[model samples]
Target: GKQITHNLKSRASEFIFYALALDESTDMAGTAQLAIFIKGVDVHKIKKKTETLAALYPLKDTTKLQDLLEAVT
Candidate 1:
């Protein structure tokens, strides 16, 4: 993209990723996840990404994040 390709490439190189599964949803959905590998994903970036995704996909109620994770598993 004519966008921030440099920054994107730099960030992309920072961590390796592995596709976890094809799809986790019971019904047809495009939602998927990536198992972030490599190292150096320090707390700051983790917090930032968590907060970013949390804002993007806010949990409507207290469904226990761990349980939601279990559902995916």
Candidate 2:
């Protein structure tokens, strides 16, 4: 986990510009799951790349917009 995180950080640092995408969904157990993705253009190769930044699970009964913001920050 630590190594993967380090690699992600290293790759993200080389991005010329990046965009973030967030998706919220419910699982079979009715738990809210938030998926975060990063889409970036490589500075050196000018190639576009997309990667999963994180998957956040809210511990609350309902997953509110504020809850998602708080989990990310």
Candidate 3:
């Protein structure tokens, strides 16, 4: 897991431009979860890469915009 994080950070540092994707969902227990992904192109090879940056389970009950924002920040 640490290696994967390192690789993602290494690639991200070289990104020319990037975009983020956020997914919010509720589990069977009604717990809200947020998943964040990043997509970008590298500066050197112009290679495109996509990676999952985080999966956050906010302590709050709902997955509203405010809740998501709080989870991330």
Candidate 2 TM-score versus the reference: 0.65
RMSD of each: 12.3, 4.1, 4.7
- Per-residue lDDT tens digits of candidate 1, residues 12-73? 45434311222222213443332222223434455332101111122223346553454334
Give the alpha carbon lDDT tens digit for every residue of 1-73 in model 2.
Answer: 3543454467678788876677888888888877666678878878656565644444456678777766665
- Best of the two (2, 3) by TM-score: 2
| Consecutive 10-residue window with the lowest summed lDDT within model 3 | 50-59
Across 1-73, the per-residue lDDT of candidate 3 in tens digits comes to: 3543555467568788777677887778877777667778768767656455644444477777887777666
Stretches of model 2 off by over 4 angstroms after superposition: 1-11, 51-53
Per-prediction TM-score to the true structure, in the order listed? 0.23, 0.65, 0.62
Q: Pull out the clashing pairs in model 1.
A: none
lDDT of each: 0.31, 0.67, 0.66
Which candidate model has the greater TM-score, 1 or 3?
Answer: 3
Global lDDT of model 1? 0.31
